[model samples]
Target chain A: MTRMIGAGRRAIAALLLLSLAACGAQPRSVPPPAFNSTDVMFLQMSLEYIRQGEQVLTTAQTRAKNAELKTLTAALQAQWAEEQGTMQRWLLGWSQPLTADPSSGAHEGHGDLHSLRPSDIAELQATKDNFDGTAEALLLGHLHNCVEVSRMESTGGQYPPAKALAEQMAATRQGQVQRLLKLQTGSTMGA
Target chain B: MRRRIALALLSIAAVVASMFVAIAPASAHGYISSPPSRQANCASGKVANCGDIVWEPQSVEAAKGSKLCNGGGSRFAVLNDASKGWPAASVGRTVTFNWVFTARHATATWEYFIGNTLLASFNDGGAQPGATKSHTVSMGSFTGRQTVLARWNVADTANAFYSCVDVTIS
Candidate 1:
């Protein structure tokens, strides 16, 4: 009985030691990149896209002839404003100064809204009869562009939180694009 | 008992290590480079007044089958504006499309078009692509000034990167 108890004690000691070693000797994986310029660019571009979308959607809410179009624009305006806030928080968390850094040249030449062109907007404003159709077409194009950028960020971005956000944004925008297509075709397809 | 514990801990550690190894690389997106797509030119400063595209040239993305120069996005709408007078590259009957990838991913296919006409296509079949890939294409009797649209479709994703290159064939 005495010998058996000693053996049991030794086994427990050995197990404890192994657990400690396991905790201590765990290999440290390579740290993620300190700052990825591309990620910075992506975040900046995403914010810009959101800003431009909000602007366009706000205008469409009033100018859109279709009731559905007005509702969609209002919903999108709220969503984009919330997303912009989230992106700004992420920028803060990443320790990136809100102001554009001239030395890094990260934010230079970065202000163009990619989805709706000036011509498209002008056409939408000019054509009062087919306002909803023009708005739908332009919004569909914008949503497609947003989806593409989000997809790239989810796959290529270094920041985990940003990547997750990008994934969610991609799904949401893709669904919106599909819904807009259905609306354009005059089909009440559920998203 | 000691051997069993050791084996279990070792198995756990091995699993952890494998998890770390499975993580993808940090950067993994790209665009067309051969004739210099509109975004590429903007990035390299060859094109002026390109707007946000000059900041991130790899992001000229949109839904597949869209003909918009800036990938159907207003932020990149400048690419669609012909008034910018984008310079055209002179090429021979045969030209290579070079794709520079910062981070490679499983690819679906690469298609090149000239004004709605399919010029050449390469099927990648969901295999992971390399950092840089070059595909030689025969211009196929089409000549003169043209805009070539190159589309890179990802196998696992619902999006594609589009590049519009202005080219003049001799």
Candidate 2:
């Protein structure tokens, strides 16, 4: 009887260990979202231009007489058209679209920064100072997004095509940063 | 007789061991229905008119000034953080939201705000800066559609973060 009891204890211990081992074999936690940093950079750049255009458009709206804003609007319209084309090409070639659908809603585009229509700019930047502040915010968001995207890409395996695109995006964003910085500093200094 | 005596001893040992098994009373954690109210669902970017916010919470803080048991608004705002919608409150109930943080005093604090209200206020707590904290007052009365606001104040100094979720009262 004593021998039987000892065997039963061993059997229970083995079963418990087996259960624990099985539990350990379960999969780990889920991975983060699939979006990479390259997408973030592109999204940020697109948003910057949108916001810049919106700022100019808003200035046009608040002023009793600002004809230059109209010209600015026209220029932005062309720029956005070009940008959309670029994004579409990338989307076509890259298996998926990086840009959000503008018609989806105000929150559709990257992080709730919606497309600024010609009409929206006038109302959005009615006050030059307010427009400037908003512009600054949008630019900051753009820069932050770029840095974030690059960080993600570094972690993602380096693919030549994706890396090249990231480089180009970084260059373009850098240029934008220069231009926006000048605009903001110029305005701040009252130059 | 010897075997009977051993069996009684074993039973007593088992009873004593069971008594030492520390059974603690279960704590009551508040629960909102698995899927929260949709009338003020802010995920879609479309504001729902009043008469939509409804949720069943198994347990909620009944403290006054709590923001957990409240919902209504012309524009309901739901923030999807990590893809989960922090459901809006409807038919206001008293709830107190508490956040605790520790920090040094007179230091530049970094903070984030969602709507117009100050959700977090940080103070340089001193050498051993204690926790910074804030809370929102959940309404006691539910009358009609009210504009729900999600506001945040990050750090020691910053503009309030603003977001809106509108819900209508029925």
lDDT string, candidate 2, B1-170, tens digits: 44467457544533332222111101111111101223223212222332212111111212222232232222222322223433343433322222211111123332222234443444433222222122334443444554443333233332222333333334
Instruction: Give lDDT: candidate 1, residue B148.
Output: 86
Interface Cα RMSD per model, in Å?
Answer: 16.0, 23.6
The CA-based lDDT of model 1 is what?
0.63
Q: Write the per-residue lDDT of candidate 2 for residues A5-98, one digit (tens) a residue.
A: 9999999999999988776665336422233333433443344445544454445445423243334344545655665565556545434434
Q: Which stretch of 10 consecutive residues in model 2 chain B shows the poorest summed lDDT?
A: B25-34
lDDT of 1 by residue, A1-191 (tens): 99999999999999999988875665437532343433554566677567656656866887876687787788777778787888888667555544334333222221222334454456566765545555665565466456656766766677777787888887777556545544654421110
TM-score of candidate 1 versus the correct structure, residues matched by position: 0.42
Error of 2 at A57 (Å): 7.1
